[model samples]
Target: MKRFLVAPLVVALAAVTLAVLPGSPAAAALIDARVGALTFRPDAPGTGARRLASASVRQDLYLDRVSGTFVLDAEPVAGTTSYLRVTFGHLDAGRSCQGDLELRTDTTSPSNGFTRSGRTLRLVATERRFGYQDWDCAFAVLDLDTNGDASDGSVRSVLIGELTDVPARPVLAVTGVQLLDARALRLVRGVWTTIEVTVANRGRADAARVVLRGSGRGVQVRPTPVGVVRDDDDTTVQVRVRLTGKRATTLRLTASGGGATASRSVRVARAKAPARPRPGTYRSADGDTTFSVSGGKIRGFRVRTTTRCGGYPDIPTTTYNTYSFRTVGVPRNGIVVAKEKGRLYTARLQLRIAGGKVTQGRFSYAGPAACFAVERFTASRRR
Candidate 1:
């Protein structure tokens, strides 16, 4: 069997463009964290300086638009042990760099065909001296597939998941899900596989909104959401996933790649949209009447409502537990309300104060049928 990886080179234009484009329109926007900045260190015991001389090699790695194909320059990190730790970090907008991944050497060559197992990337080394007894050598690829800032997170914390089980007992992960309107897709069931990914975004200002695409014997994940993380002024990255088996099906999760790309260490069991109005106080203009809030507390309610479905049309169906209040500086405990066509609502409003001559205040609400529960007492702050 022959390995087929291109030589790894220094940073290329593709990487540079993604990293150094702050004056452009995307400047004010989110730059891809994976290509933000990059840092890869060669760690060896103090005694292995001899091996270091033979392996101090550099490579230019290019990630495809979808985070799948990667082209490494035709060179190896100079001489030495087959077990050197290769770390790849992401860089955000500035040139600030950070570590992203560390690969273990098994049967490494100029060209390598990598296999993915669950969330791990595996490559068998032909050199048996590296001590890999199996038919092939293995390495893990870390892909967080999230949306925030990767570099913003500390190196120790960000790469914690990646650091833990480098020599992992491969497990399949649901990298992405593509909902097929096709009737055939609906008939399929559970299947799995692994994915090696690298993202490329035309614009470096933000994480590219790209999705992962995969095909299985039967089953699929529909519209997987990817989070963006900005790290390493070198926000550029390459990640891999392990997926379980499904019937004949295809699943995809899109993300901005390259300067637009964002990668991280992620663990996903499964994702699904949450249900509405399962068990909570509800207020609605038109729906099945279920629950309500009453008493003075519901009247002095002072909290923002979310169930934010949309605009006015959404408001009528909003299960927001609206309450009115008279006195400020009172501790208000909020609750969940389902959107239902009802008359009154319920709430609990609390007021804390020390012993003193207290003034009487009033509470009132003139909206549709509003109700509340009110309780007053003195709560001394801990000394």
Candidate 2:
């Protein structure tokens, strides 16, 4: 149950000869230079025999060759297995070619198996034999299978060549962020605004399980999850934030993945005083609904609605109706209730008046044992 993960460590070389002289060719290009070795151990009690003794790797750029050796501290008991992961620094030169990798080992029975993910290699080894199982990779992996129950020693020498298939390691960077909603330009205190944030990934590989975080004074941001973003591609996500105070502020958004992070900020300003409700016939932006307002009442209110209940069609049917309602609060904002009621639901409307018109509103029809949906809309005074 113990797992050891060896991260890639860079081992700097002081000098790399590149020039070719008579009868002597230059070494292969050092596309990647890094720490080339790692070791793992088993910590679980009563499992000392299953621990990894040691591991070593070497790279000879001139011959395009990579080699490694692995040994277990002791022979493991039957049915006992240990898992280990090791990462070699930047071994990929291009896209990962699991098929281009050629593997060889000493023992083939009681086989140890291994798999590759990106540059990280996973191996399952026991006391007998460790060998490479079928896997795609961008780096070298030693698959060992110890010959029949050898209680003496488990030593593996892996000779691997054809190292040209490794891909360039993928780099993740948050390229940019864009505010897709105009409401973000002017934020109102104590009101929640849902804005669209477009997160872009300019990377060599797809970013998985991406997350967006927002921060600011007088602001409350809802952390958003943005799933896989393919290399060079972008995805947009919605973020809901509330400004709790009148002070102007800025909202900072950051996206991170693959050890890289990027951030962008948006300016927020206190909203101006709201304009009074203007008396006029207003039409919804969609032109599918309309309502008229006079000082303290809403008239000629019309919208589509649906309801489903016992004795009604399984799928709610749609219908349009004209309604009249009295404002129950301030002239700028109030709830309007219709006098008529159906057996399954009652109709109600909430309206917000600003900038000389009915700026936004919600219409709902609901009751016990019924399905009622709230429809939200915006309308401007008809010109």
lDDT of 1: 0.26
The TM-score of candidate 1 is 0.19
| CA lDDT, candidate 1, residue 40 | 33
Error of 1 at 330 (Å): 39
Per-residue lDDT of model 1, residues 66-128, tens digit only: 111221222223442122333333332433223433343322331233443322323332322
Q: TM-score of the candidate numbered 2?
A: 0.36
Q: How many backbone clashes does candidate 1 have?
A: 126
Q: What is the lDDT of residue 200 in candidate 1?
A: 36
Model 1 segments more than 4 A misplaced: 1-206, 212-214, 222-229, 232-256, 259-320, 323-383
Models 1 onward score TM values of: 0.19, 0.36
Winning candidate number (TM-score)? 2
lDDT by residue (tens digit), candidate 2, 256-334 = 7655567877787776546666677878877766777676555677775444443354655444444443344333222
